[model samples]
Target: MTTYHFVGIKGTGMSPLAQILHDMNYNVQGSDIKQHIFTQQALEERNIAISSFDKENIKADQVIIAGNAFPDEHKEIVRAKELGLPIYRYHHFLGEFVKKFTSVAVTGSHGKTSTTGLLAHVLEAANPTSYLIGDGSGKGMENSEYFVFEACEYRRHFLSYEPSYAIMTNVDFDHPDYFKDVNDVFDAFQSMALQVQKGIIACGDDPYLHQMQAKVPMLFYGMNDNNDFQAGNIQVSPEGTTFDVFVRNSFYETFSIPGFGKHNVLNALAVIALCHYEQVEVSIIQQQLKSFKGVKRRFSEKVVGRQVLIDDYAHHPTEIKATIESAKQKYPDKEVVAIFQPHTFTRTQTFLNEFADSLSQADAVYLCDIFGSARENAGDLRIENLQERIQNSHIISEDTIDCLTGHGNSVLLFMGAGDIQKYQKAYESQLAS
Candidate 1:
């Protein structure tokens, strides 16, 4: 058997895919930068060979799967081409690989990762399930009955996948780098919806998704009675949130999740709807939702002294808004302090005002410098541009992280897609001192 080699193996999606293949007893190994990443722990636990990029890493017996972030000009990719080895882009390979099992593709502008993780956990109790979560989690079970994976809409890569069913949480304009506008993003999702072999489970509340046309049945789930699957009689407390599930205006059952926010309730609704259709018992779904530990860096929390520190991946404006709301719900007595690090120049420029409005929802706000990835160059915008829009928002750096301690037991939400953890790390070190 040919060994599967991954380029840029430490990436968010790439790490989990490598882990899944390794679990299946495949010869999995890869290369990346010498710098350490949190995702590398999973790969190393499996004893997968991970070395720094070099021409020697490529051999005639290897099958290369190039990460989306890397280009053909990279040394490893160049070496693979010279040797005439089989090469596959990450998305292309995943599209073909998922066909082997009963697949459910979780797609949307947001909530894909959380919803995907929820589905995998719930389904595993009912069937032998394999999953690829965006939070760097994946497992390949022997004789797996289903394959559930997170499918992203960046650059229309999700269209490459043809899953049996799809759960589109919502369709909002994100990834401003590639998509020109909301309509452009909708067009891509519309194309993806048509390709589903089975029915589609979608959030009916989204106006863009409501306008979508597809040959497959569009099953809607939301808080409103108009939806095929609805959540009503909601209750939220410090423990978590509970709501009644109404199937076509009649109560099916009541469920609780160990999480706050309406967005989370909707995520559970999508999972409940899909599993109900598949004949999974309501008791199993309820149990899994209640016990879900949640995905990494998504409202993940810990208590440090008096302050509540949370790490979340809320790069987009809408996601930032939801994160703040959840924080407020969980700790109504404390302040929600947002420490936001913008991911890319294009996204920051495109959603500058929108970002300001969302961050202003918090009791206090701190802004970090924009993180530029290898894919794009610096734009004309600066971090101060966003700071000026929000009244009294402080510009923070790793050196000034101590200022956060002054908030007096506030819920500090460290939100970003980039390396905002370093700021949290800096604060933790100061607290230790």
Candidate 2:
């Protein structure tokens, strides 16, 4: 058996691939910077050895899978080249591996992780399924018949895949650091849509997505009658959301999921459409959809005293709005407090007002300093600029996180893609004291 080495095993996408290979009974080990990330917990549970970065970690009898974050100049890459061992970029390796089974690529600017998790759960009930979810979740069956994975559109990375089917959640302007504007982002998804081998299941509500022109057959799903797969008669209560599916304006089934927000409904609808197309039993689809426990760091919740602390990866303005809406839907009686840390300086600078407007939807708001990258290290943007836009918004640090304790019976949304969890951790420690 050949050993598989992941250059950056703790990454959201890389970690899951490592887990999938590990579950398949492959010899797997990886090297990273030694900082503890949430993804490492799953790797640790499997006893996958992870060590600090060293060129010596690479051996003669290994196939190296490097995360896209690492470049040719990375020490491990240099060593892998010296040995003339096969080295595959993470996406390139996934693209090849997916060809072995009936593959479904879930891609979007937002909701990819949540939708991928939902689909994976539903599909596993219908067939022997393997999945790679963005929240660092993966499972492999030795005789798997279906492969479900999340494909990101950033830098056109999703174009690396040629899936039999795709679930396009939406196309919204994001990642200002890379693409020039929303049209640039649209062009990238449009290019990816052309690569689907069989069909595409896309959300029809998105103006950009509904207009997508692809060679493969497309089914549009949404909350309105305008879509090929539509969900209507929706109701939301504390328990969850209930909606009826209409296929070609005909009633198909009524499904209820223990998740709130129109985004969640649309996500479930996308999965339902794909499962329907695949001939999955409707009973199995409904059961697994409701039983999905959710992915890591995407609205992960814990209760302490009178407060509900939710850790979510809602870095974009659109995602922030959806998360806040979900919180409101689930806990209408409680105050929804948003503790937001802007992920990147460029993104904060790009969507400054948009972020402020979305965050203002919450009952109260708290802002954390921007988490920046070295590539676009210098920027005029500041978190105070965002704080200035919202009335009564507080600027907070991990040291002063105790201020959140004042919001009694509140739903605290710890939202961001960066190291925002540190603030949550600090606050949790405050509660313990």
Candidate 3:
């Protein structure tokens, strides 16, 4: 058997792919800087060994898979190239690995993780299904007829995939580091839609995507008259959201999901549409979606005393707005307190006013330190810069978790794509003490 060594193995996608490969009885081992990340727990549980990045770890016969977060100058990757070992980019490897199975790629600016998780859960109920989700969830089956994976459109990386079935949740201007404008973002999705081998299920409500005419049979789903699958009469309760799905202007079935927001209702509709196309029984899909607890950190909730704390991986303006809207919908009576950590310098500078506008929807807002990635850093951009644009937004540091200690009966939401969990842990520790 060939050995596979992943160079930055504990990434959200890399960890899950490592787990999937390991479960398939492959000889797998890897390394990462974030060795103590929550995703690391999964690797340790499977007895997968990890070392700090080292040139010595690159053996002669092993395949090296590099994580996207790391650059070509990464120690192991550079050493592997010099040693004549076969190297693969993260997305390149995934594109190849998913082709053997009937692949379902879920792509969008937001909701890809949640929709992918829901679809994987629902499909697993009827047929053996394998999935790789951005939430660091992955599983392998000895006999899986289908593979469901989250396809991100950032940096136009998702173009590497040609899925058996592709689901476009919605398209919007994002990844300001790469794309120039909203039109640039739309062109990428249009390209993705054309790459699908089987069919495409897209959100019809996205005004930009509605105009794209494709060669594939595109089934539209949303609360719109033009959609082939429409979610109507939506109701959001404490239990979840319930809506009737219509196919071709006729009532098909009523579906309920244990999730909040109109965005989630549309996500459920996308899953329902795919299930119907795949010929899976509707009852099985309905029960699975309703029972799905949720993907990790996508509005994950915990309670301490009278305070409800929610942690979500919402970095962009659209995502932050959706997460807060969902929180308000689920816990209507509680005050929604938002603690946001801006992800990257480029993203923050690009969407400063947009971020300020979306964050203002919260009952109260707290801004944490900007989390800089390995990529670019535009000059002099700071959290205080974004904080100045919003009303009643306080600058918070991890050192003063006690400031949030007595948020009596408030819904404290920690939102970001970066290390915002540090703030959540600080708050929880303060409460514990």
Candidate 4:
């Protein structure tokens, strides 16, 4: 049996890829920092051995998969190189592996995970399907006919994939550390669009995506009437959101998803458009959309006492605004409080004003220290700069628990793509004490 070893397996994308490999009956083991991460839970449940990073874990016979975050000088990577083991980066391996099945790569700035998860769920109901979500969830079947996965645009890594069909949710300016501007980001997506084998289902609402030119057939899905797949007569409630799908002005079907915000409605439309194009039964699509519980950390909610706490991976300004809007829709009568920890110094510096404008949508806001990356210099950017632009905003610390607890009957939204959960965990622990 071929053994597969992973470096930095606890990462959100790495963990899911490891799980998928394990489920496919491969002998898989990995090494990462001992720090606890939510992504490790599924790995542990599968009994896949995870150990602290060590060069001794590398074997000449095993293939090594390295996480993108790790440098070529990493100890395990050095050892693997010494042994001349077959080494592949995460995205490169996924790109090659996905060729085994009819793959659907869901790509965009936001909603990639949710859309991939939804499409996976819907397709699995009809046929054997393998899926990898960015939220650290994956499943594999030996005879899967369809493989659905999230394709991130960061650093142009998604350009590695050549999928059968592609669903692009939207194109937004994000990952400021790498790309120069929105046009730079669009060029990457345009390059990726050309690689799709069958067709592309894109959100027509985004001006950037609207300008996409693909060699394959490109189908547009959005609220706009000009789209190939249009969503109309939308209704949003605390329970969920429902919309009618129209295919080029003809009513197709009415679908509902157990999620809030117009973004989610657009996500489902992308899934519906692709599945319908593939000739999947409409009944299966409707049933799967109704049952999807949503991907982890994308509007994940829990009730503690009279307050609702939502944890979401909304690091970008556009995503932050959608999260705040979702909170308001679900709990219209309660105060919506946003607790955001800006992810990277470059991103924070680049979208400083935009972040302030979006975060101000909440009734109250708490800003935490910017989550710094080892690769970037912090310079002079500070959380204080963002707080100054918002009305009811304050810096959050261990001392802010008292102020947070004062907001009764409120929705507390913990939003970010960094280690913001530590702050949420700290607040939860204080409440317990």
Candidate 5:
């Protein structure tokens, strides 16, 4: 049996890849820091062996898969090199692995995780399917006819994938540490679009994506009439959102998803377009969309007493606005409080004004210190700089729990891509106590 060893296996993307390989019956074992991450639960449930990082873990016959965050000098990587074991970076290996199946790559600035998860759930229900989601979830079946995966654009890593079908959710200026501007981001997507082998499903509502050039046949999906696949007659309630899907001005089916906001409706439209292209039955698509519990950290909600606490991975300004809008749709009569922790210094500096504008959409706002990245140097930027921009906003700290207690019958949205969960978890414990 071939053994696959992963270094830094607890990472969001790495954990899922490890799960997929393990499910495929590969002898998989790896090491990472002993910190208790939510991803570790999935690994433990599968009885996958996980150990503290040690160079001695490297074996001669095992193929090494290294996480992108690790440097070449990482002890296990160094040992793997010394042993002359075959090695691959996470993205490169995923690129090669995806070529074996009829793969669909979901890529964009946001909504990739939810869209990928929804697509995977829908396809797996109707047909044999294997999927890799960015939320530390993956499944691999030996005889799956399709592979659905989230293709991230950060550092242009998604260009490594050559999927048969690609879904471009939207193009926006993000990952400021890597890409210079929106045009730079667009260039990366355009290059990847040309590489799609079969077809492309893109959001026509996005001005940037509407201008993309692709070699494969392109299908547009959105609320716009110009889109080849459009969603009309939308209805959003506390339960979910319902919309009628139209293909070339003809009514196809009315689909509903257990999600809120126009953004999610657009996300469903993209999936609907792809499934329609593949000739999936309308009933199956509708069933799967309604049944999907949603991806972790993307608008996950928990109710405690009269308060509804939402945890979301919405660090970007656009994502923040959408998350707040979704909260309003779900709790129309309740105050929506946003507790935002900016992800990286570079992103905070790049979209400072935009962040303030978006966070203002909430009824109440709280700011947490920016989550610093080792790769970037923080200059003069601070969370206070953002707090000053929004009127009546408060800085989050140890006193946050006491301050939050003032609001009753409100949705407390803890939003960020980093350790903002710590704040949420801390507050939840206080609430319980």
Candidate 6:
């Protein structure tokens, strides 16, 4: 059996891909700093060995899979080069791996994870389906006919994938570390659009995506009447969301998903559109959407005392706005509090005003120190500067947890793309104490 070793295996994408390869019967193992990441549990559950990232970990016969977050200078990466063993970048390996099955690559600036998850759930109900989600989740079926995966636009990494069918969730300016502007982001998506081998399912609501040109047959889905697939009579409640799906001026199906926002409703709509195209049973898709429990950290909820704590991976301004709006729909009577940890200096600077505007939607706002990228320097930009723009927002730490403590009715939302969980853990421990 060929062995695969992943460098920086704890990374979100790397870990899931590792699991996918392992389930494919490849002798898969990896190395990372012994951090207690959520991905670690998945690795442990699969019996994938995790070791320290050392030169010693690199073996002559093992193929090395390098995490994008890690540079070529990483010890194991260097060792792999010295040994001249075959190595593949995460996306390169992933792109090649999924080609064996009928693949659906869900790509966009936002909602890819949730959309992929929903699509996977639907496909699994209709037939065996394999999927890799951004939330560090992956499953490979013994004989899955369909493969559903989240395709990211960061660094144009998704360009490596030429999926049979591609779902464009909506393109927006994000990953300040890479793309220069919204147009630059759109250019990347357009490139990906041209690479789709079969068909394209795109969101009509996004202005940027509307500008794209694709060679494949494009099916547009959104709330707009002009789209090929439209969502109508949408209803949002604490329990979930329901909407009627219209295709080519006819009511195709009435669907409901146990997720809170219009964004989620849109995500469900995309899945339904794809299922219709695939001729998946509408009843099976509806049942799967209704029974979906959701992925980790995409508005995941935990109740402590009477207060509900929601954990979300909403780092960008648009995403934060969606999460807050979803919270409002779910708990209209409760005070919503947002605890945001800005992910990167470049991103924070790029969307500073938008971030302030989104957080202001909440009843209370708290900011943690900006989570700097290992590649970035701590510039003059500070979270306090963001607080200046956001009235009633305060910089918070474990030392100041008492200031916001004892809120039994407030919905505490922990939001970011970084290690914001540290702050959540501290606050939860304080509340427990």
State the C-alpha lDDT per candidate: 0.94, 0.93, 0.90, 0.92, 0.92, 0.89
TM-score of each: 0.99, 0.99, 0.98, 0.98, 0.99, 0.98
- Please tell me which model should have the higher TM-score, number 3 or number 5: 5
Worst 10-residue lDDT window, candidate 5: 396-405
State in Å the error of residue 69, model 3.
2.2
Q: Please provide, for model 4 over 239-310, each residue's C-alpha lDDT reduced to its tens digit, 9 standing for 90 to 100.
A: 899999999999999998888888989999999999999999999999999999988998888899999988
Per-residue lDDT of candidate 1, residues 82-135 (tens digit): 999999999999999999999999999999999999999999999999999998
> Which tens-of-lDDT digit does each residue in 120-146 have in candidate 2?
999998899999999888988879999
lDDT of 5 by residue, 1-433 (tens): 7789999999888999899988988899989998888888888889999989999999888999999999999999999999999989999999999999999999999899999999999999878999999999999898989999999999999989999999999999999999999999999999999899999999999999989888889999998999999999999877899999989999998988989999999999999999999999999999999998999999888998888999999999999999999999989999999999999999999999999999999999999889999998999988999999999999988556668878899999999998889998889878778
For all predictions, the C-alpha RMSD in Å is 0.8, 0.9, 1.2, 1.0, 0.9, 1.1
Lowest lDDT sum, 10 consecutive residues, model 4, at 397-406
Clashing pairs in 1: none
Clashing pairs in 5: none
Residue runs of model 1 more than 4 Å from their true location after superposition: none
lDDT of 6 by residue, 1-433 (tens): 6689999888888888888878878798999887689987898999999998789988878999998888888888888999999999999998998888889999999999888888898898888888999899988876879999998898889989989999999888998888898899888999999999989999998888777798888898999988999999988766788888889889888888888888998888888888889999888988999999999889999988778988999999999999999988999888999999999999999888999999999999999999999999877998888999999788998678767665668789999998999888887888778
Residue 425 lDDT, candidate 3, scale 0-100: 94
How far is 354's C-alpha from truth in model 6 (Å)? 0.9
What lDDT, from 0 to 1, does candidate 1 have?
0.94
Query: Cα lDDT of model 4 overall?
Result: 0.92
Lowest-sum lDDT 10-residue window in model 6: 401-410
Q: What total of clashing residue pairs does each candidate reach?
A: 0, 0, 0, 0, 0, 0
Off by over 4 Å in 5: none
Clashes of 1: 0
User: Model 6, stretches more than 4 Å misplaced?
Assistant: none
